[model samples]
Target: MGVGVLDQTGATFAEYLPGMRAVIIADENTWAAAGAGVQESLRAAGIDSDEPVVFPGQPVLFADDAMVLRVRDILAATGAAAVSVGSGSINDVVKNASDMVGRPYLSVCTAASVDGYTAEGAAITVRGVKSTVTCRAPIAVVAPIDVMAAAPSRLTATGLGDLFEKIPAGADWLVSDALGIEAVDWDVWDLVQGPLQDAIADPDGLRRGDLEAVEALSEGLQMSGLAIQVHGTSRPASGAGHHFSHQWEMEGYGRDWAIPLSHGFKVGLGTLAMCALYEIVIGIDLSSIDVESRLVAWPTPAQDRARVEALQPAPIIRESAVRASAEKYLPPDAARERLERIRRVWPELRFRLAQQLMPASEVEDILRRVGAIHHPSQIGVSLEQLRTKYFQAQTIRARYTILDTLEEAGVLTDVVDRLFAPGGYWYGRSPEPRWTDAS
Candidate 1:
């Protein structure tokens, strides 16, 4: 299906009938940014809302009881047949809330920061923990390329992160299918794969603020939404990476942390870390490890947090990475062979990944460009914070991705060392990869 566009022309909301009765919900930031245009558009479309609900700040927390109560009151008063949300958070709120009321709603996306815009479930914080609750996908998703291109660079970066997540996530899904731990949806995969590739290949299109890139991103996100709808769960779009993010949210550290990264940003980092872990693992052999030696003594979150805080620049992250590797059940040669086999099957794997995968190097560059924090130092997030998130991430999600695989096999510590090694693939504070040397 072709995309649905509703430019800021102030006529988009007219697509719905005036008599149809609807409530418009938007957060303060979004409301101020585009409120006039949206209201004008609705008015032009012959749709008039007696009440428009606008909340302060962004709707980052889905389980805010006050917001829920307010929305419920709005719905009750409007007796509206539907809702039209003007932001991602607003969309999730309206969508999930509408689901509760058996009402349908449409959304006009304001930022590309999240994939939830088109997904069938809302990621909400319930009782101070991030939780994914199933909701109906919007009946329509509207976006104008002009509006999207003008969004902050970080929002675009977040969108890129969301798109990048599909790789590790898809791999985990495939592995689950192989192990019979979860069911895979080939159709869902089929739908998203093309748009995903298209988006990755043309990331320059995004950096250049190309309208086509915006369109592709929008399309890819929507495809992800449909995939969730098809699977009746987020398994198709989220995996270990998401778990890591969720775990961080649940641990309460991320909540109280000095600087909080977006869900996509945290998940993106996890994806990169997990992919690196997987590569290290698949490069080895599996049967050689002594089972007893491979078990994680399973440190407490507090201990893990302390270890993370104690991380000294590059050595610390690498130590944890290497530690993770040492415990992996798979031997280095076998793990390497698996990667080689995947390469044999899809010769373009690395090339394709090079586009979407935001390594620490890429993240560093972007962070510098946008003046955003890229280092643990920049955010004042000590190694303890990282440890807390990492450990918690393993606990929240059920997927057997790289972290789980390593923890299960007992090579987690070794992998941590390699991952955080100075000059390693993760970026910054590095002794450098031993094989490559300065000229």
Candidate 2:
């Protein structure tokens, strides 16, 4: 929580897990980053512990079912409280594992690479499907400003990318609220939005390892997790933006460990893509959306299920589509009312969304300032590839994102196609990754 807080890892443990035996779980690289210091400090403060478990980092660590089970096994054998000493993957591993054994765990962040530090769910790949699993979040997170500032720049970029996605995520909530699909919790919304701009305001400072900037970024990321914890659903923090990231990971963009994609890298592109999609959305003439025609052409639940089955996406993706489509499918009577609602709310809803969403160009500028991936090709995904994913992504999540709303109104495909066509907002923008950055 401050400079040199790594020296107080023991104090964090005492305050959060008093009188309990501690188990340190980290990957080898993270062990070197902060694990070793935490171990020494805990002992110096008189906390008993078992030998730390350091996972091999040869292939780059990822959060998956196997890693969770390994940590769970360690927890079961030791019967000790856990200390998760890493970012993203490592924290999720310990978080999910600790949940399995009904134990409390705290986080000792080595980098601000993600906001899952105090999140209620763990992003884990179970049986090849990368999805969030419901689990207990870390009890407390100890982020040392100096330690975070010393980590690699790309990891900081990842954290910014993760943090920035919230811009469009907020707009997506507006979409759901307008459609009556979901309601926004304003208190929880402010928890993240209140500090978002200031938290990520210093991309250049962050690049130069400014301690102030680092602390802001760290606190901002933690605030996001706190918001997630308060809401009890990722709906407030996730939307079409995350669906794009999940689509990439589930279909094997993440299967090749040699090149190794960071989650935030993909999410950065997803954020930009969603922003671009929002641009198209704001221009659509919703007044003439032809609601009656859409309802007439709407697929029956059985037919929609058949349509999803026929897309022939990856099995897991297809499975998610089927489940989501069935859950969201509405009979013509209800759907007629929904479409009418959209037409009625379009003007005010669009205005509200405009207030909420950042322009794609500005989002890209912020990402470039922080050295994050802001283009499709950075992770080997092309504009054409992205175009295809927009359609596939809508079906993968039952959650009501703007994509779902557009599909209900029958404009999702046409709008996305226009974005990639010549003269569209994203037609020739950042075709290759470019950054005017500080470091």
Candidate 3:
């Protein structure tokens, strides 16, 4: 399936649609931006198409069950194939809805905002928790450079942030491989790594809305999505940073009475945080840790539940967190066993992790140059929240990340504390700097 990144996106869509009727799925904003033109293109191609299915929303459209049902109903009633004409949310909703109706769909991307456009999974809210629902990849992806470049700079920057996540994401995969959780797939890794590095090497053009930069960013994100498709897992493009983003979304932190930051932006901030943690892990002296003492201090299940309750996440999130905590809450004997394994392989693991992650400072500088938000505070998360939830993020997913390694070693708290201390990555910038000192 060819991903068309051309000026003639409408023409490309016409070629794909052929004689089939298409239902243009888009939100109001997307309809204004590119949906109308896509409809006209179908008309010009002599293909029957119904009036566009314009979702009612302002600023953003969410990929929730209701929206998915609405689109599926429209497609079923009209007996038309779907042609999603928007970015992340619209594309995700259509992807899931089309799968429900067992119909192939095409994606007309309007912004370089996320990798979901071409991925096999839809990032949707299920039962009030942000989750990835398995779905079919679009039959074809059409990203017009002009449309992408015209997107708000924040959207493009968010796209850059999403691609930048691969740095820490790759490192996390290395960690998982070291721990025998999941081995890396070099084929899938190669799909996004080279393009990701080249896309962000110099983001000045992206900031200025240059077409080349827009194409590069759009292509990079699309490739990332394809990477996920090839691997049959999100590991190639998601890791610790993505877990942080999912946690914030589940808790409704950034979305409370405010426009939520894009997924890329949230993950970008998360990427920085994860990188900082990686630095700490690399510098740790394994011989110095008193494994017995740390193991004895490990929190019991009761204590873990109490701490999770104190955070007061949504009921569903709290339930999930409490359940997941069991996996990480190891007894002294179990902890000692894990600690011994970690100690035996600490040097090799440290070297692999260090080799995989870019310096936190370097990642931050690139994001800043591209106008991406690098701090969690930029998206309304407080230091207290970060401190409380950083570890929780690890529990929310069964995946093993650098966070899991730190937690198992009983240094996660120390690492978070130092990350928020003065001269640290998040120092003086979080909503509550005083919390850092107390921790």
Candidate 4:
């Protein structure tokens, strides 16, 4: 029914075996990265070595439907209670596969890179469209601080970006509420938002591998999953930014020809853009607000065939987004008049955000920080190619995201170019490695 976190604990898998004979599912990379330690710990905890089953290849590369069926077959044949040995992609495969077969599983997180470790839904690319499949939340989230700290830096950065998304996503939820498109629960807002704010304020704690910070961020991720469970939809945790990521996943096209960013990273950029767009449309400053950036140096679309085949989004999606922007993100007319807010502040906010989230800049920084692919050239995408056909990326998802909103309002293309141009506004904030500045 919920999640349990085991910190500095070895052989945590031993606890799940009584429920069903455990089958530890891990991919090649994960097995190499953290499998031996987990195996040793499990053996020490009294679970037999024969219980673990390592899936072939990397989890991300195994998102194909055939792989899911293979995993399901393994589980059914072994009658093993599902347990995953990685984060994000691996967890998603096991979670979704287990749910499809009505089984419970536990996740031993090797990285703190995504909020999905405890989420009840799996983000899967099916038939080239990135969509969430109903799934079971991990019964336990087991990760030692040392193990998580040792994870790939970009993976940790991805987690930071995922946590940062709450600010804009929560705001969008409010916007949707105002437009009568969906109901917003203040309870859900307070539940996840509180921890998210704490994590952002003290991100340095994470940088130092502080147990409290790591635990808090992990909790926040689970809280987001719980929020979705409360709402019976992703509305409480995902919004326009997620839609943009889904669109890119489906279309496989990104401007500036950058490598495909993670879902969290893509949403992070979309959050900044959505926030800026909200200010532009609603006429507010919001400049005092500081949001962390999730840079994408070159984001070329990744799904070519799907992008060409999908239809443009429904018109109401855009209309609802605009109405939501005007009603929620922007102050109501009377409130704006009395509050003495400056509309001019919006342009400055837009430019600053655009600069900070520039694909090229993000690519360089991420590459330096995580040693991951950062350039469009590296990913085989070019600006000319994207500019000529990037519109296809906008059609992959049915969700009404910020891009869709901008397209509806007729400002998306211009804004995208202006934001990515040379000497364009780059508002990236300096990374502080300690919480001293936060307090």
True-structure RMSD, every candidate: 8.5, 2.2, 4.4, 10.4
Question: Per-residue alpha-carbon lDDT of model 1 for 333-395, expressed as tens digits?
Answer: 554454334334333433333443434455445433332233444334554455445554554
Top of the candidates by TM-score? 2
What TM-scores do the predictions have? 0.74, 0.95, 0.89, 0.66
Candidate 4, residues 1-439, lDDT tens digits: the string is 1122332123445554453566678878677767776666665665544567776662244454566777888888877677688878888888888877888877888777777876778877665445578877876667655667666555665676676667656655554443344657889877777777555444556656566666666677777877877776777777665654555555544322322356665565445445444444443233332222201111123332223333344343333333333332222343333122222233453553343232334334432343232233333434444343324334444433444434433355665555346533322322323211111
> Which is the better candidate, 3 or 4, if ranked by TM-score?
3
Runs of candidate 1 with Cα error greater than 4 angstroms are: 1-4, 7-19, 57-63, 202-208, 252-260, 287-374, 383-388, 421-439
Which portions of model 2 show Cα errors greater than 4 Å? Answer: 433-439
lDDT of 2 by residue, 260-364 (tens): 677787788889989999998988877677877787798988888887777646777888778887898889999888888888999999899888888888888
Estimate the lDDT of model 2.
0.85
Each prediction's number of clashing residue pairs:
68, 0, 0, 19
Name the 10 consecutive residues with the lowest summed lDDT in model 3: 430-439
Top candidate, metric lDDT:
2
Give the CA lDDT, 0 to 100, for residue 369 in model 3.
83
User: lDDT of candidate 1 vs native?
Assistant: 0.58
Worst 10 residues of 4 by lDDT: 291-300
Taking all chains together, the TM-score of candidate 3 against the true structure is: 0.89
